[model samples]
Target: MEENRKYPRVRTGYQVRLTHRQYGYWVGSVANMSEGGIFVAELRPSEFTLGLEIDAAILGEGWDKGLPALRMKVIRIEEKGIALAFVEPDYPLWDSGKLSESTQSPNQ
Candidate 1:
């Protein structure tokens, strides 16, 4: 098959938390990442559906507790995992002020 991805992906081991309004929450590890999207592995396929909007938060060692979750849309599903594309690709992930008011923690 031809590789038609717009952005190149890099392998990663970052832990990620994904939350859905209907499916609850899932914790998985990132398989790879690209500017346009991310692939997360080890999550149950039955919990996701293509085109579903979800929130993703990278759980790094120094991950900011105040940072808002990134909005992503499910684009693909496979045995390995599910692929998600950023809903707002150009959104400033590091700018807490811009997103703080619009998002809240899943725990809340």
Candidate 2:
């Protein structure tokens, strides 16, 4: 919420998947997300430093909505995970129906 307004963030609590060539595989939760990057919460701090390419999956409704499994470059690192920028998104993320649409409605 706060991150996206300032930096194109993705939905928090969304389960995300991370993978690397050498590290093999790992799973994490999205602490924060944005068009530019996402913060993951892994079991342990990631060895992935800046400039590493990784495949990320944004889990959606059942499994089909799962974000296009895009790649990202580690731009920042945290104690529990890493922040990454989108290598590529399935389509224009903002307009695509794959992700849920805002339901703020017209009353507010």
Q: Which candidate leads in lDDT?
A: 1
RMSD of each: 9.1, 7.0
lDDT of 2 by residue, 1-108 (tens): 534345755567678777877788778888887667788876476467689888887775655663467888888777877777877656665844454446544554
Q: For candidate 2, which ten residues in a row score worst on lDDT?
A: 95-104
Q: Which stretches of candidate 1 lie over 4 Å from their true place?
A: 62-65, 89-108
Model 1 C-alpha lDDT per residue in residues 6-73, reported as the tens digit of each score: 99999886889999887789999899999998999988877889999999998877668788899999
Local accuracy by lDDT, each model: 0.88, 0.73
Q: How much is 101 displaced in model 1, in angstroms?
A: 26
Best by TM-score: 1
- lDDT at residue 39 of model 1 (Cα atoms): 97
Candidate 2 residue 41 Cα shift, in angstroms, is: 1.4
Models 1 onward score TM values of 0.74, 0.63
Q: How many residue pairs clash in each candidate?
A: 0, 7
